[model samples]
Target: MILKRLILIAIVVLFSCSHTVKGQAPDAVKKTFQAKYPEENDPDWHKDDHGYYEANFKIDGIKYRADFNADGTWVETETSIDEDDLPDAIKKVIKEKFDDEKITEVEKVESATKGLFYDVEFKRKGKNKDVEFRADGTILN
Candidate 1:
C-alpha cells in the first residue's frame, strides 16, 4: 500500500511541475500569434527564459517562430529566410564584398528592442562566418 501511495504522489508531482505548454497555446497567445500569422494554426508552444511564450510553426515550407508575453504582446520573431530571398541591397553588398563566399543560411530577425536585421551565415573554403546587417546594408558587426 505504501509503494502505491508513493507512485501516485510521484505522478502528481510530475503533472504539477509540467506547465502544460503543449499542443495548443493559451487563447491570448494564440490570438497574438494569429494577428501576425493569420494562416498558421496549432503551434508548438514552449516557455522562454524571459517568462514569455514561444510558438514554433511552419509557413510556406519555411520554419518560423514567434515569441509573445502572457498579455498577448509581441516579443520578437525569427524566420528562416532563404539566401535568395534577401533584400536587393543586402544581396548587392554580399555580391560585391563576398564574391566567392557561399551563403549557407539567412534569418530575418525582428525584435521589439533592436528592431529588424538580417542574421546571415556564410561559408568560405570550409570556414563559416556570421554577419549582422541593417536594412540599408550597413554591417553592424
Candidate 2:
C-alpha cells in the first residue's frame, strides 16, 4: 500500500509540473514567430504573466527572447548586450544621470509599440532599479 501511494504521488507531481510547461503556444503565435525568426527552428515557448507568448531562442550564439500576442502580432524582442555596445548617446546619459548606480545588466529591446530601446538595470545600496533609454539617449522610464 505504501509503495502504491508513493507511486501515485510521484505521478501526480510529474503531471502537475509538466502541465505548467506543456501549454503549447497558439498556432498564430508559432506562425508569427517562425516568420520573424526564420533561422531558429526550435524555441522554448512560455506564456508570460501578461498572457503573451514568449519564445526563447538563440541566433548566432546570442540568446534572444521574443514576445507575441495570441493574434500573431509581434510585441517585442530582447537580447543581452555589453555596456560597451551601447550607443554613445545612451552612454552619455548613463554617465550624466546614473553615475552613482552600479550597472548590473543591459539589454537591447525592440518593441512594436515602443520601437527600440535599451534596458539598463542598476544596483544601488541593496536596491535595484531599471532605466529604459532610446538609442538617441532619450529616457523612457
Candidate 3:
C-alpha cells in the first residue's frame, strides 16, 4: 500500500513538471508578457519550481532574455550586445585597459538589485577574461 501511494505521488509531481518547462506557461502569464512586449515575437518560455517564468528571444539579430514572476510581473531583462553597441565610457575603459585583448562578447544586464551593468568577455591569445563594469565605466570585477 505504501509503495502504491509513493508511485501515485511521484506521478503527480512528474505531471506538474511536465507542463512547467519548454515554452509552456499559463495563459495568464502569456497574456501579461504579450501586453508588455507586443513587439517580441515567438518567445520561448520556461517555468521554474518557485513560480518564475523566463522568456528567451531575439530582437534585431541580438539575443535577449526577459523574466517574469508567477503573477506575470516583469522581473528584468538581459540582452546580448555587440562591441560597437557598448557605451562610450565602457569603450574608453576597454580601449585603455585591454587594448590588446579582443572583445569576444558583451551583455547588457538590467536588474533590480544592480540597476544596469555591462558584462564583457575578452580573449588574449588563448586565455579568456571576464569583467563587469558600471554604466560610467567603473569596473566591478
What local distance difference test score does each model get?
A: 0.84, 0.89, 0.82
User: Measured by TM-score, how close is model 3 to the native structure?
Assistant: 0.62
List of clashing residue pairs for candidate 2 = none
Model 3 over residues 1-141: C-alpha lDDT tens digits? Answer: 999999999999888884446557767768887887798858988765556788888777778887787777777788988789889999999989998887888999887567899999987666788898998999987
> What 10-residue stretch in candidate 2 is worst by lDDT?
14-23
Ranking by lDDT: 2, 1, 3
lDDT of 1 by residue, 39-130 (tens): 98778888766777888889878788788888888988999877888888898999899878778889998988779999899886667898
TM-score of 2: 0.82
Put down candidate 2 lDDT per residue, 1-141, tens digits, no spaces. 999999999999876553233238888888998899999888988777787888888999999999989898999999999999999999999999988878999999999999999999999676788999999999998
What's the true lDDT of residue 28 in model 3?
A: 72
Q: What's model 2's overall lDDT?
A: 0.89
Task: Work out candidate 3's RMSD over C-alphas.
Answer: 7.2
By summed lDDT, the worst window of 10 consecutive residues in model 3 runs over: 18-27
Pick out the ten consecutive residues of candidate 1 with the lowest summed lDDT. 16-25
The reply for model 1, stretches above 4 Å from the true place, is: 1-20, 24-26, 49-51, 95-103, 122-130
TM-score of 1: 0.62
Pairs in steric clash, model 1? none
Better of 2 and 3 by TM-score: 2
